[model samples]
Target chain A: MLRYTEDHEWLRAEGEEVVVGITAHAAEQLGDVVFIELPEVGREVTKGEEIVVIESVKAASEITAPLAGTITAVNDAVEADPGSVNSDAAAAWFFRIKPTEPDLTGFMDEAAYQAMIG
Target chain B: MADTPGGLRRTPLHDLHLARGARMVPFAGWEMPVQYPMGVLGEHNHTRAKAGLFDVSHMGQIVLRPAVEWPSGHARPAAHEEVNDLKLRLETLVAADVLGIPQGRQRYGLFTTPEGGVLDDLMIADKGDHLLLVVNAANVEADLAHLRTLEGTDVVLLDARSLMALQGPEAEAVLERLVPGVAAMRFMDVAEFDWDGARLWVSRSGYTGEDGFEISIPDHRAVEFAEALLGDEAVALIGLGARDSLRLEAGMPLYGNDMDAGTTPGSAGLGWSIPKVRRTGGARAGGFPGAERILAELAEGAKATRRGLRPEGRAPIREGVPLYEAETGGEPIGTVRSGGFGPTVGGPIATATLPAHLPEGATVWAELRGKRIPATIVPLPFIKPSYKR
Candidate 1:
């Protein structure tokens, strides 16, 4: 199951962990992604806390956590090639987080996320 | 975002910009385009390679006329005495030697405050009968107020005029199609011409380090002129985003960002604009505002001087980033005033204020988002200017 946050982050449940990345809408708005600073693995994050910093040629943006969790792993590939986020935002997962709260409340579904962006 | 105080003013080409899919943003009380569909990097590179058209009507254009009436009324021959008197009177407000500029020529000048800080940087064109001054949009009001304080000069704001800049190596060729004799005009030369029954005040000068022309036309004919220029295959409509990056790469300092009212001409590395005629030893010396402090600073170097910085990595370091000594491991010694990813350089570059004692090629570290990135101070401009003599 996939869930979206108002801040344009997406999370997908992968058994015991969840994958996180920014939405295509957010990536398109950010223009070209030149650099990204991802949180280190094992860092404790609360809901709506800033975890990633993405920079384009023009400006910078911060991505917040959608749920309380501990960062399990990060995508080294995206850090190596930040442009991949603009190429395919959905597939370019930023990190894997093990949710502290199993019940992911306050997240929107696919339709809700689409409507929110619109 | 909510509307700012006083609302945003649209330029004469606002409709055309929207039609061309420009991303409009608030800039200095104007709704200006930040970038077009081509994006900042593409637009920047295109201007450097070919020609780029920019709508800079947001800038303030004013004409200063002498209060004195012509002696022979209708048939005046050159009126050299009146022009000379007017130039001398105008020189009281600026640091540049305005009286020395010949007819049909323009020079870069600065309006310095009483404390030696720069109020605004402007271009003054000696138009024989009157002087045409082009100032930054943000400083227009203050500049006008300052100019109004003069006793014998009549300052008239050219609000109905639209200013456009066509810049690049091929700018001359592209502009020659519309104005036949524009190619002959040297850098900083201003001329009045007729284009399709409309009058134009064109100058062979621009903010970009490239050879270009700044065309001032009636507001009603702006869209027509812009469309005609865009009709050329070599000319593309560029936005403020590319303009900023291009000027930064050219080592041009912005008024409010790079050098504000707190920064003096000596510290901003713009002492060249203060000609020798205005110095202490010259004939007409120490007459302009802050002349004493400015001349002193010129002889004895300022505490901080503006320098070009080249960061080591690809991650761009933006403005307000602190600068630290390379090996001292102490507090910040300076701050980045203007910085961005230079599309032409293909990496991050900046202009910062560092100790005047720091020589070129000195190593410094810029603190971006908490990490100290090593950068080297180099001689400006990062790219050589291609102005036609």
Candidate 2:
């Protein structure tokens, strides 16, 4: 399942952790994702809060966390090659975090993500 | 490309951009198509290898008449040409000779306040009888207001046009076929001609370092002109995305990013723009903002200056990031101005300001999120300038 924000961030869950990245529409709009600053592994982030900064050729964007959690693992590859997000946003997760309070029942699913993008 | 400004603004070719499947975004209060379906990389490469048609109508395109005074004796709104030309003699705008700027030639100029502080930087094209000015979209209203106050001669300001940019290696060939005789115009020259039954002022100039032209046409005819240009096989509609990357590769500075009111021409590495005449004029140099400080800086030399930065790896060091000394990583020496992944350069590049004495190979630090990233000082225009002689 994938949940998206009106601002174009996307969130998904993997077991106890949630994976987050910008949606394809957002990545495309950002042009080239040249640099991405991921949050530290132990940083506590709240839902709908800015935790990452993604810079493109034209401007810098703050990527908001779709859910509250403690960051666990960051995709160093995406930081090393931010263009991966441009090529495949869904697969180029910025980080994986375990929610401080997990309850996936309230989040939007894949259909909602598609509708939000549309 | 479909991002309409809702209540902001829609360029003359707004519909055309959306129709072509452009990914539009709000920029400087206007709905601008930043790129088409071809994406940023494709559009960037296309403009480098071929011709890229850019709908730059969001930029304010104004025409100037010589200045005129009312019966009350108060000067009318300054025509763009008159203010620049008249002020040039007085050195009121900047320490540059506007009148000497050849007809059809494009020159980068700045508006300096009495204190010698920068008001704005713009591209001014002298068109013999009149002047054509292209100002930043965000500052159009303010620029117009400022120009009004400086109109001492017979002149009028007209905002009845939109502009487009056709840039890249094959740009000249495509433009030549569309508008003959443009081929003879040297880089920085301006010429008037017809395109699709409408008259236009074409300048052999653009932000990108390429053989290109910036065409000014009636607002109503912009869509038609855009369509006609796009009809060519070699022309692809590029948006702001590619425009940014292209300029980055060329090492050109964006007004608000690499420069602002606080930064002086000397510190920004724009001393070349200040003519030699102004330098020798000494006491006669017209007073602009921070005149005492800027002129002093010019005479004494800038403390710190803008330079290009190359990060060691693919990770980019962005703006607002601080730079450190090479040997000991002592005090913060400078800050990143414009940093990004330049698709044309195939690497990460940045424009930063640092101590003027810092050697080319000097190392620096860019605070990316909290981690200090290592960066090296390098010469600008990450790629070579390819302007037509």
Candidate 3:
């Protein structure tokens, strides 16, 4: 099951770790991504803390952490070639974070996310 | 494209831009198109390869001439003596060879403050009987007020006209199809032509560093004229985003971004535009508003100067990014005036203000995300101008 944040981030829970990536709508809005800087693994972050910086041809954007946790791993492929995220935003997970409490009770579901975009 | 953001003004080509699927953004109190479906890089290269149509209606067009009128056409015309009088009077504010500008020629000029800093940069054209000034879009009101203080010249704002640019190697051929004799006009040449029962002011100049023409036509006929040009296979609609990168590659300085209230003509590498006649030893020297330091800086090079910087890595070093002499802990030496990915040069390019006359091969460090990026000073204009001489 996929969970969504109001800031256009998606989280997929796999056992104890949660994978985080930007939504397809966010990617489409970002235009062509030329460079991206991902937060380092082992860095502690709180909810709503900005950790990702994406520079597109048109403008620059920052993605924030949805749930407070420790960054366990980051996707190196997207950082190596930032354009790949635009091709498949859902598949280009930025990082994996182990939530402090493992609670996603506040996150929106798919139905609520769809309505929010509309 | 629907209702613009509150307080944001729309150009005459607003509907036409939306019809072509442009992405609109707020720019200097105006809702302008930043890019179209072709995208910024695509439109940039397209303009270089063929021709690109740009809606520059946001720029201010003002007419400066002696108060006495001698003709019916244009904002106003003057007798030859009045024209010369107007030019000399204009010299009181602008630091350029206003008296030397031949009829039908345009030259880059600047307005300087009493403290020797640049207030704005502009294009001054001597249209035989009157002088036409084209200035930056955001500086319209300020420039008008600056010009309003001048005596003996009627400063009229020709706000009802829509300005457009057709640029590239194929620009001359594309424009020649509709208006003959444009092919004969050399660079910086300005002329008046009658098209569709309206006066079309044509100048063989543009901001893109390509061989091009800037046309001023009536606002109501802007859409039809643009449609007529877009009918050609070579012409495509370009927006502000591409216009920016194009000028960056050309090494042209933007008014507010590159050279602002604190920049002097010499510091901005614009001393070449200040003719010898206006310099220290010339016949008419030290008359303009900021002549004291402008002439002083001309003789003795400015302490701070503008130069190009190329980062070693592919990541773009953006504007307002501070630069330091050392990698880790030192005060910033400069800030990026204009910067972006140069599609033509196939790398990231930036221009910044650095201390004058550095020793050979000095590197400035730009810190981004806790990492120091090394950028070496390179000569301006990542891409040399392709203007038709």
Candidate 4:
């Protein structure tokens, strides 16, 4: 199952962990991504904390944690090639977090995400 | 987003920009296009390779002439004697050598405050009949009021015209197709041309550091003119975002960001625009505002000077980020004035006002998102300017 946040982040459940990345709508709005800095793998992050710093050609944006979790792993591929996120935002997961709360009711589903973007 | 403080003013090409899928943003109280669907990076790279059309109509355009009376029901160009009178009067407010500029030419200049700081930066063009001044959009009212303070000069704002810049190497070929004789012009040369019976003022200059022309067209015919230019395969409508990157890559200083009322000409690295005639030990010197401090700084040196910086990583150290000499706690050495990714240079670049005493190749640490990022001081013009000289 997939979950979306109003801030344009997406979460996917994979076994005991959940992967987080930005939506296609967010990537399109960010223009061309040139550089990115991902949080460390062992960093403990709280909800609404800025974890990822993304720089496009014209401006900069920060991606925040949607829920309290410990960063299990960060995507090295996206950091190596920042343009990959623009190419396929859905597949380019930013990080994998072990959430303290397993409940996913707070996040918007696919239809809700589409309606929010609209 | 909602337009604040009443509403935002739109240029003549507002609807045209919407048709081209532009993202409009508020800039200097105007609803200007920040980017197109192609994105700022693409537009920036495209301009470096080919041609890009820009709408700069929000900038202020004004004409200054000698306050002379003419015969009833008729007006005439400023005579040779009156021309000298007009030039000398203008020298009181600006830093450039107004009396030295030849007719049909222009020079980048600055308006200085009475306290030795820069008030605004502008371009002064010699138009024979009158001197033409192009200033920043935010300073329109202030510039008009300042120019009106001149005792023997008449200030008139040219609000009915639209300003467009056709930039890059392919700009000549694209523009020469619609208007002839622009090929003969060189950098900073100003000329008047007629387009379809309408008076077109043409200047062989632009902020992009490319060989281009800034053409002033009437509002009624601006859309037709823009469409005609866009019809060419090489011409694409560029927005302010790419314009910022291009100008920064060219090492150009933005008025509000890099320099302001609190920043002096010496600290702003604008000594090139201050001619010798206005300096000490020269003929006709020391009459303009802030002449004492400006001349002293020119003779000696300013405490602070503008310097180019290359950030450690690809991430840009944006404007207003504090800079420190040490990695940890210490007073900020400087603040980034303007900075972003340099698409042409393939890295991040910035410009800042640093201590003049700092040695060459000194490294200053910029605090980015609470992390210390080291940036090296370097020379300017990260990319060489390609002006047609």
lDDT of 1 at B274: 87
Q: Candidate 3 chain B, which ten residues in sequence have the lowest lDDT sum?
A: B69-78
Using lDDT as the measure, the top candidate is 4
TM-score of 1: 0.93
* Candidate 4 CAPRI category: high
Ranking by TM-score: 4, 1, 3, 2
Candidate 1 regions exceeding 4 Å error are A102-105, B1-6, B70-78, B326-329
Docking quality band of candidate 3, CAPRI definitions: acceptable
Q: Which stretches of candidate 3 lie above 4 Å from their native place?
A: A41-44, A70-72, A98-105, B1-5, B69-77
Which one wins on TM-score?
Answer: 4
Docking class of 1: medium
The C-alpha local distance difference test score for the whole of candidate 3 amounts to 0.88
lDDT tens string, model 1, B1-389? 12335698888898899999999998988999988988777889899999999999999999987776567654333367777888887889899999999999999999998998999999999998889999999999999999999886788998789999999998999999998899999999999988998899999998789999999999989899999899899999999989998999999999987887789899998999988778878888868788889889997878898999999877777889999996447989999989988878877889998999998988999887678889999999988899999
Please tell me how candidate 2 rates in CAPRI terms: acceptable
* TM-score for each predicted model, relative to the true structure: 0.93, 0.83, 0.92, 0.97
Q: For candidate 3, lDDT tens digit of each residue in A1-47?
A: 89999999999998898999999888877776777889999999998
The predicted structure with the larger lDDT, 1 or 4, is 4
The residue-level lDDT of candidate 3 at B152 comes to: 74
What's the CA RMSD for each of the models?
Answer: 2.7, 4.7, 2.8, 2.0
lDDT of 1 by residue, A1-118 (tens): 6799888889898887889999999987887787888999999999879889898877988998877889999999999888899889999999999998766556899999989988
After the best TM-score superposition of candidate 2, give how far the Cα of residue B377 lies from its true spot, in angstroms: 1.0
